[model samples]
Every structure is written in structure tokens, then in C-alpha cells.
Target chain A: MPAEGGQQALNGAARRALDAVERTGRACVDSISAFGYGAALFAESFFWIFRGRSIRQPVRLTMIFEEMMQIGIVAIPIVTVLSLTIGVMLAIQGIYTLSLFGAESRVTIGIALSVTREFSPLITGILVAGRSGSALAARLGTMSINQEIDALRVMGINPVRFLVVPPLVAMMVMLPALSFLSDLVALFGAGVYVSLDLGMSLPAYSDRVIEVLTVNDLLHGLGKSMIFAVLITLVAVVNGAGVTGGAEGVGRVTTRSVVQSIAAIVITDMLFVFVVTR
Target chain B: MGVEAVNSDRSVLVEVEHLVTHYGARKILDDVSLKVYEGEVFVIMGGSGSGKSTLLRYMLALERPTSGSIRVLGRDVVRSRPSELYELRKKMGVSFQSGALFSSMSVGENIILPLKEHTDLDLKTMEIMARLKLEVVGMAGFENLMPSELSGGMLKRAALARAVVMDPKLLFGDEPSSGLDPIVAAAIDELILRLRDALGMTVVIVTHQLESAFKIADRMVVLDSGKLLVTGTVEEVRNSSNERVQQLLNRRVDEVELDPEAYLKRLTGA
Candidate 1:
């Protein structure tokens, strides 16, 4: 009986070991499958975008307009306010440091360079990701669980073309537009802080901002914003369009969309800074 | 009308031969072979998880079978290229169980979707066509309303309107009468018949509702446990000698026999 018990225990251990190996294998397969699915979806979106553009598949102009208004126009007030605050805070911190070195007047150059080249685009990307990226994922995820995506497929409509391209085009247009507005507002904010709090002339602050900002800086910031736009749109769409498991899945993927978009934005921003600053 | 009054010269519209499908390790359809005739209501009836919907998906060319062939409109669905499938799909229409109307678009927009995609009809013509279909579905004045505003029955009707708008050669509806009251269910069933008769489209409906299935099915295919149990006329199925067929038709659940020792061990966690 004792020998039988020992043999059973050994068999149980082997079974658990096999179970662990099976679980690990399943997880690996799942990860690879998800990665492959996301890549394929991304490629399909682009195929419809550039190829379908030339072929003249009916693009919904109204939807592009609507998404543009939602992502860019509706966001104007909040983006403007947040950018101005960041500008003021950057100037305040810079002014304190500059004062210690007796280089107070030079703070405008620092504020202008940072806001135009990095802060404006980065901040706009973060905000849009939280606002519009999450919205896209949540909306698409709900549509998916409701079988609207499958319905589109059965109707001979390409889901990527019908559902994804409008937001994509809207992002391409609006992200740069938002970034431009952010740049202007942040500069104005820095000017306000310099003239009022630091006792510098408004005209002098403006002159320094203009002097510090080069054509290269403006292009770099806009270029970064454009890439950020693509990342946010694609990540949100992939998460949303791939949702399963009904309501809870929508929530789960929505959270994933925001988290993934933000991480992608930060990493891309770091790379852009590394390359562009060099 | 009995079987004799229905024309016997109809051509086959959809053909499935020895079809097999699997979901992971579990077989979902096993050697399910059937034919759908043109201008007839072919109902595939089964309990949940019996693979009727999966079969419909295959017939619609949205899924591939593990083995065997499905030919819709004389084209092998498994071997068709994407472009070929798209062309074949244009000849077919499918109404989903949940209506699947674009929530963002009004009912009018949904009905005119296929027309806009496949035809160069002017906005006025599309609108008129959409209105005409809505009227046919008894939803004439509800075109401007969004999908969210429609009741379940109205949503299903509107979805049907959208499906038939392009006058497809074949119409596949999934669970048309599901979640409806018997009266509403009967009305949808009648609509299916009218569509088949008027449009001359082959109709394939996958449903679990026996009453609706019996009321409309010209010929029925019954599935159980991912396998075809029987396929025959209503009377033939009613008179079937097969134990599984009788079990299903009489709404009897099979008793599962378990070893008493094992049952007790599981229950007592010993």
C-alpha cells in the first residue's frame, strides 16, 4: 500500500510538470498569435489606405470631418489650457535656475526651444492618446462584440476600410494641427510669464522666442507629432477591432489601448529626441 | 402548398460535401453534407453548439472547413481567392442574429449601404430604394431613426431590409426568429418566405426554434453534437425511427450515465 501511494505521488508530480509545460507552451503560442494578428491588421489598414486610395474605393468624407472635429476641434480648449500651464511652469523653473547664474533674460530661449521641439508635441500626443485613442478602442471594441464587424464582413465591406480609414485620415490631419496650436499657445504662455512675473518686456520675450526657434525645430516637432498620431490611431484601432468576450473585454481592451498608446508615444518620443537632437 | 405544388425543377444553389470543421481540439462539424435548392426555404435546425451557425458561416464563405468542399453559386468557396470570394459574396446576403446595423448610421443609410458600394446610384435614387425596402419591411417612416432607437423586432426587420436591398441571388439569415415572441417569430418566418418567392433567392436559415423551423422549413436538416442527425421533410423527420431524431423532436434530454463510485468520489472530493 505504501509503495502504491509513493507511485501515485510520483505520477501526480509528473502530471503537474506536464501541465506546467503545456501551459507555458499555450501562453507562448497565444503571445505569438496576438502579435501576428496585430501586425496583419496593421498591414491591412495600410493596404486599404494607400492602395484603396488610388483605386477610389468610396471614402466617407462626412466621417473624416466628424472625427476631425472630435479629435482636433473639440480638444482645442483643453489642449490650449494644459500647454499654457506647462509653458508657465517650465519658464518658472528655468527662471529660478537662470537667476542663480545671473542669466535670467536667457530663459526665453530655453522655454521656446523646449516647448516647440519637445514639450508641445509630446504633451499633445499624451493627451490625444488618453482622449481619442481610448475612445476609438472602446467604440470599436463595442462594435466588435455586437457583431457589427462580422456584419460588415458578410456584407462584402472591408472592415478596415469602412471602420478604420476615416479615423486614420482624421488623425493624420488633426494631430499636426493640434501640435501647431499647442506650440503657439505654449509660446504665448512663456511670453506671459516672462513679461509679468519676471519683469521683462513682452516685446523682448517675443524677440527671444523667435530668435531661439529655428525652422528645424518646428519641423522636428511637427514630424514627431505626425508619427505619434499614427501610433495612437493604429494601436487604438487594433485593440478595439480585435476585442472579444463581450462587455468586460471592451473595458479590458480599452485600458490596454490607452496604456499601449502612452508607452508607444513615450518610447517613440525618446527615439525621435535621440536622433533629432544629434 | 404541398411539395408537389412547389416546382421540382429548381437548381442547387449551395452544396456542402462531407464538410468537417474543428474549434481547437473539439470537432464542431462532422461530415455534414447537404444541398440548398434555389427558391426554397432550407432550414438548418439544431440545439446550441450543434454547429448550424458554423455551417452558415462556411456557406457564406466567411470560414473554411477542415476538410470537404462548399460550393456557393457554382464556385468552390474553399479554393476561391479573395477577389473571387468578394464577387461571390456580392451575389449573397446574410442577416445576422443581432441585426448588426451600424449604430452610428440611420436605418436609411444602412439599407442603402450595398447599393452605394456596388452601384453608382445617385443619392436620391439610393434614398428612394432604401425607403422602398423599409416600406416592404413595414418600417417605411422609421428610416431616419438610428438603430439604437429600434426595438429588437424592428431591428431584425430593418436588418432584413438591408440584406435584401441589393436583391441578392441567395439570402442566408441566422436565427431570424430567435428572441422574438411566437407571433413576431411567425411574422419573420412569413417575411422569409415572401423574400424567397418575390426575389427568387435561395433562402437558408439556421435556427433552434422548432416551432418556427417547422412552420417554414420546406426541408429540414437537424444537427446534434456537431453532427448531422437527419435531413428530411417535416413529415419524414416527424416519422423518423432514429432515436436521436425522436429525442430531439419530442424535446427529450438524454440522461448521462455515470459510474456511481466515480460520482461519489467527485462529490465527496475523496
Candidate 2:
């Protein structure tokens, strides 16, 4: 028993030493990774701030606009449909549960608050993370793996300006727009359910929602959506640029980016809720 | 053999001294030193995993050395600031092994990316420059095609056009003939030699293709196991008695197809 205990202690000590070494090595790599991402973000932000002056070509503008349209306008129908479906489900559940308390009128308020404060932005962000963020990461990751980023560097073009900036700017601008659109669709769907299914007048439900939901609610949601946009795009760029191993590495990074972005959005939402409520 | 005469010239385009590179715990390049003079086609030849590409990266300032110094165009590439590195890279050009064209853009846009980024040339002027380079590389009229639309050889040509679009004083190519047919590879080798002659540009090529290297290299360096084995003109290298060099240079179909058992028994006296 003593020998077994001693052997177990030795194993634990060896594990601890191994873990300490891994942590120390990974700390350096993490710092390097952080610095690379920081540089990319800084370069992207700088390009956007001075885009009009820096990018003068008409073709470049067309490319930027086309990308924005693909990311924002083309995605609207999916976002709207998904949000509407979610809203309908929430409304049915809310009405059915509230009826047990003989307080079905509160269903409108419930739908309004839930959709506005959490569901709309969260769902929209996840959609964007899965769809747009993954696409961006995969595209850029392939480019990095193929040495196209090195080509840009050799050309004296800041790759962050050329590759990361336009997409990032478009994403930041479009995600908020998508979130706003999603809120409208969700609210409208919820209203439809309340009016037709629950026998409540549209005017009465909307009035009740407006009365309960202040402007601060919309702003808080939008604020959260904006941060989610930033985080998704940042994770996409970091993972994309960090792709070192090839096609499989790109796939892994894209999956990690979407998962990390969604997780970050949820955590950020919690903090945002706390801040807004306080 | 004549290191003193080569060092006498102040027109060294690239100089490396005692370079060391490590990937994780494994050393990839060890104490490597070489000098490339202006207007020379310096070929770096080695088998796979011999750190030929690593040396090119260090020379281009794409990767920093673990120890020792690299000077490219009179600027220290290893320890330069970001802005300094960016500025120094302006005078240089590189064509990667994969061609590395922006897949999203047309060949025309890929060729003109450098002009668009660094120069103040208007659209018409940039277009003209792009056309001129395309014509130079025998890739004229393919500008509107996307990278994905082009064949491997055409992509390499387009990448080469882009690399020389700025009329850089030095050019670096990593495996320029890789993944291309023999005819196309030979054409590329000829184009590289012609470009050197016409522009008087220093060309440093990292390739494992012995035939292509022999055809184009004015001077060649061979690396084995992360260390330089020999460096000399092709004639000197072919005549050398170094066993590894002789083995590598003499590797032909007849030799490789010999019965391994008999050859080993005969060679090893077993």
C-alpha cells in the first residue's frame, strides 16, 4: 500500500511538471497569437477609418459593396424566417404556460422582452457565426495555407488592409442591420400569433409591448449584437490567419471560430444583461 | 574557392552569416552562410526537409533567424522594425511555390495588386503595366480570368508577372517549377534566365529540381540535413568528389532501377 501510494505520488508530480511545462510553452505561443490578432485588428480598423482616401479604385469599391450585399442582403430572408419561426414557438409556449395562471395577457410582454433582449440577437449572431463567420474563416484560412498571404506581403500590400478589412467592416455594419431586421420579424410573428391564435387585438398587443419595452431595451440589444459582431469577426480572422496545417486545419479553425464566437456571445450577453440591469 | 574575390564587391544583394532556425525543438537550419551578388541567379538546391525554403524565408525577412544575421539590399532583415521590413520588401519580389494568386480576384487584379497598393499609378497606367508584364511572361490576354480558371503553368506565369511588375532589384522564387509539366518548367526556367539577363535583377531560387537548377543557376548551393554541403558553379559541383554530392548528381533512372539487393551487396561487400 505504501509503495502504491509512493508510485501514485510520483505519477502526480510528473503530471504536474509536464503540465507546468506545457502551460509555460503555450503561454508564449498564446502571446504571439494575441499579438498577431491584435495587429490584424489594428490594421483592419485603420484601413476602414481611412478607406475613402486609401482605396480610390472603382473596382475595389464594387468588390466591397458586392461582398456586403452577399453578407447582409442575401442573408436577410434566412434570418427573418428563422426568427419568425422561433417567435411563433415562443409565443405558443408563453401563451400556453401563462394560461395556467389565468394571466395570458402577459404573453405579449413575455414575447417582446425575450425576443428583444436575448433571442433575436443571440439567434441572429449564431446564424451569422455559423454561416458568414465560417465562410470568412475558411476562405482566409485557405488563402493563408496556400501562401497567398505571403504573396500579399511580398507585394507590399498590407494583407489586413486587403483581405481582413473589407470583410470585417462589412460584417460589423451588416450584423447590426441583420439584428434590427430580425427583431422586426420576430415581433411581427409574435404579434400575428397573439392576434390570430389568442384573440388579442394587434393594436392592444403592440401597445402593451411598446409600453413595457423602453428604448433602452432596444439599445441594449443592439449594443450586444454589435459586440457579438466584433467578436465573431475577430475570431474568424484569428483562426483563419493561424491556419498552418492545410485544408484540415482550415476546417478545424472554422469550426472552432463558430463555436468560440457563439460561446463568447452568450458570456458577453450575461455581462451585458448585468450591466444594463444594474 | 575564391571567397575573397566574391567579398571584394560591395554590391552584395543578400548576405547571410551563421543563420540558425528552429521549429519547436527541432533545428531546421544550422549556421548557414551564403552571399548573393547583384544580377546573379543563385540557386539553393536540396532534398526535401533540408531547409532550402527556410533559408529563402530568412533572406526575404519572412521568418526571423534564431541566430546570425541576414542583410538584403543593405538592410538587416532579421532584426528590422515592421515598418522597416515593409519598406525593405518594396525593393524585393517573391513568387511562391503555389503561385499564390488571390483566388477571388481576376488574374489582372492579382498582377496589379502591388501597383495598386504601393504606387500612385492611376488605373490606366496600372492596366498598362499589367499588360506589359503579362506580355513579358507570355500570359497576355488571360488577365480577365480568375486564378481558379487558369492552369497550373499559367498561374505560375501570372504570379511571375506580378512578382516582376514592380521591377524589383531582387527576386525570390520558391520552387518555381514545381507541379508543372517538363516543358512548362523548362519554359519557366528560360523565362527566369531571360528576366535576369534583361533586368539585371538578382534572382535567388530555392528548388529541388536538379535539371532546372543546372539550366538556370550561375552559382548553386546544396544543403543536406540543415547544413551546407557544397556551393559552387554547376561545372565545379559536377566534378566534385564529395560522396553525397556525387550520389545526388549521379542519381539517374538506370542507377535507381538497379537491383537493390545486388547493389547493396556489391557496395557493402557483404
Candidate 3:
């Protein structure tokens, strides 16, 4: 009887331990399922957005122009200022480092290539993601929480077609345009620094930059900007639609949109480098 | 109960039969059944947490019932294809308790959304239709105003205008009188009645306001604790002998004094 009791106790302990393991495994599976569900929803919504036709042409064009003005024209002064400061610092560092080999002319090519091919697109994407992406997320998130999306659905209007498609199309088309403007400002800033600090004539330094930065370089930067724009907009809309907890959820989605956009931009930039360089 | 006999001649708009819904482990609705005939007002009355809104959603096909069936416009809502559901939803309109207007769009745009989606009407025609609907809802010349600019009563009216912009055959309103003054609520009720009289649309309203339900309902159903208490005309419900029905109708004196937990305990003798 004593032995039987001890065996029963042992079996009970084993059963409890097995149940604990099973419970933890089930919890992990549930979490993974939720994550997969969210990801699938995001993917489906992305396709739905792409499939939608923009109905209001004039309104869509106006929105595009407005977004470009806000993201590109209004952003020029800051980009120019930052580029000039960075150019001056880069020139100073380049001169100091290259003087070890008595090769200061390389500073012109270095700053030109770096700014046009990478820094210009990267910095501009970060700034725009902070401004436009957060705004998009907050606006759409508020709409979701407020049941405006449901209203649109009941009205037999596709909310994605009405709300997201226009903005996404605008972003994709305009980001490349903005990247071109950014590259121009960055090159101009580098030229000014080269003329002042490197003792090179303005025309001569500008000629060298034009030579070093080929059409391939411009295309590469513009391509990255387009990808970054799509990423930012997709993240914004997906996070916005996923928001469920009301005002705090909107705020959380806005923050997540910015952070995720920046991260995606960086990762995509790396992928672009691998492809383009290879 | 013989809704079939009444609807044998006319087209039956919505028929809900043995509808059951569960939220996780809790059954929110149990074997609830009702019919909304054409050109009539049907109201669902229940206290808070009694699954009135769940029933509305089920009727609207926004939610799938765990068991039983709902036939809206003679189509099985639960088993219908996506295209069929979309077409069915186009035939119906819903006005939420919170108005649910897009804050970014002007009142004109909100009204024009449905017209833009389901019709090939030009901008001029759409604008004219929007203005007409706005005027019908007593919101004339408020086209350019944003939703934020409207009062609670005006918002509901605007939402109603938008809801009927498509000229839907059926209208579902959840808590039509909630969060409004009595006067405003009365005005909304008047508008609903006028719409039914003028357009001959089937209306289903989910409300807790006894006065609004009594005033507008041609036929009514009351739900108590996720179970159907009674289905009758306003006078019949008012003169009900059921204790739950009595408690609900008399409001404060009978309801608050008879605590639900104590009643349950006494009934169970535990």
C-alpha cells in the first residue's frame, strides 16, 4: 500500500510537469498564431490598397501636390542646412585623413558620391517618416477607433480605395522627386564646402562632382527613396488599421509607424547596396 | 408569431430565426428570432449588456452567429458569398450610436461617399443628390461644414442623411436617442417616422429608451439576460404580466429594489 501510494504521487508529479509544458507550448502557439494572423491581414490589406482605383482624380492630384510641397519644398531648407554642415565636417575630416597621403582632391569625389548615393536619401527618408508617416498613422488610426471605417464599409465604399491608395500613389511618385531635390541640395552644399575649405574653384569642384556621380548613382538613390516611401506608407497604414484600443492605440500606432518605417528604410538600404554593388 | 402570414403577400425584408451568438465562453444571444417586414418600424429593447447590439450586428451580417440563421433580403447572411453579402449590404443602411462620420471629410463629402462608390453618377448629379438628402434631414446649406462643426443632434441627422443617401431599402439604427436631449431625440424619432412613411423603408432600431421605442415601434421585442422576454406591439409590452418585462417597463422602483444577484440566489436556493 505504501509503495502504491508513492507510485501514485510520482505519477501525479509527472502529469503536472507534462501539463505545465503543454500549457506553455499552447501559449507560445497562440502568440505565434496571433502574429501570423496580423501579418496576413497586413499583406492582404496591402494588396487591396494596390488594387483600388483612385476615383477623384483632381482631388488625388491636389493631395499629391500638397504632400510633395510639405515633404519636399518645405523640407528643403533643413536638408540644405544639414547637408552644408555635414559637408563642411566631411571636408574637414577628409582633408585631415587624406593629407596623410597628400590626396585632398579625393574629398570632392568622396563627399559627392556619399551624399548623392546614400546620405541624401537616408536622411530625407528619416525626416519624412517622422513627419508624414506618423501623421498618416494617427489620422487612419483615429478613423479606425471612431468607426469611420465601418461607416465607409456600410456605405458600400472601400475605405482603403478611398483613403490609402491616393496617399500611397502620391508617396511613391513624389519621394523620387523629393530625393532628386535632396541630391541637388546636398551636392550644392558639398560644392560650397569644397570651394571654401579645399581651396578648389566652385566650377571645378562642381565639374568633378558631376563626373564622379554618374546616372547610375542618381538612379540608385531614387530607387531606394521609392522603396522607402512604399515601406513608410505601408507601415503607417497597416499599423493604423491594426489599432483597436482607442486614443492610446492611435498614439502607439503612430510611434510604431515611425520606428518601423525607419527600421525598414535602413534594412532596405542595406539590401539595395547588396544588389546595386554586386 | 405568424410573421409568415403577414409577409406572404409582401416582400419580407429581414427574417431572423433561432439566431444564437457566443462571445468566447459566454452566450450573448440565445435562440432569438424576429421579423422586420417592409415599410414598418421594428424595435429591439433591452437593458445594458443584454446583447441587443450583438443581434443588430448579426442581422446586418457584421457578425456571424454561432448557430441558427439570418435571412436578410431573402438571402442567407451567414452562408452568402462575399459578393452577395456586399450586394445585400448595399441594400441596407446603418447609423451607429456615435454617428461614425469621417472627421476629415466635409458633410457634403460624407453624404456623397455612397453615391460615388455604387453609382456612375457625375459630380453634379452626386452633389445634387447629397444636397437633397441633407435638406431632407433638415441640414440644408450645411454641406461645407465638417462633422466636428455639427451638434450631437445634427451629427445624428447628418449620419441618417448619409445612411439613406443610397436609398437603401432597410435602415438599422443602434441607440438612436442615446446621448441626446429629449427634444433632439424626439426630433430624430420624428425624422425616422417620416422617413418610413415617405420612403416605405423597413427600419430596425436597437434602443434602451422606452419612450423612443414605444413611440416609434410598430412591433417590438425585448431581451432580458440574452433571452427573448416577449414580442408584441407597444401596448401589449406595456401591459405584460411577466416579472422581467414588468421590472424593465416600470424602471427604478421595481428594477433597483429587486437585485438580480439576490433574485438568482433565491431562485437557486444557494
Which predicted model would earn the best DockQ? 1
Q: What tens digits encode model 3's per-residue C-alpha lDDT throughout A1-278?
A: 99999999999999999999999999899657645754664455466554434422123456566666765677677766776676677677777888899998888878877877888788878888998889988999998888888777666655665566666777777677777777777777767777887788989988888888789888988989998887887788878888978799999999988998899899999998998889
Ranking of candidates on lDDT, top first: 1, 2, 3
TM-score of chain A as modeled in candidate 2: 0.87
Error of 2 at B257 (Å): 20
Q: Against the unseen true structure, what C-alpha lDDT does each candidate score?
A: 0.88, 0.86, 0.83
Candidate 1 vs 3: which has more DockQ:
1
Model 1 regions more than 4 Å off:
A1-36, A53-56, B1-9, B268-270
First chain TM-score for all predictions: 0.88, 0.87, 0.79
Native contacts retained, all candidates in order: 0.73, 0.73, 0.55
- Models 1 onward score TM values of 0.93, 0.88, 0.85
Pairs that collide, model 2: none
Query: Relative to the unseen true structure, what is the C-alpha lDDT of residue B219 in candidate 1, on a scale of 0 to 100?
Result: 88
Span of 10 residues, lowest total lDDT, candidate 3 chain B: B1-10
Among the numbered candidates, top lDDT falls to 1
Q: What is the lDDT of residue B107 in candidate 2?
A: 98
Better of 2 and 3 by TM-score: 2
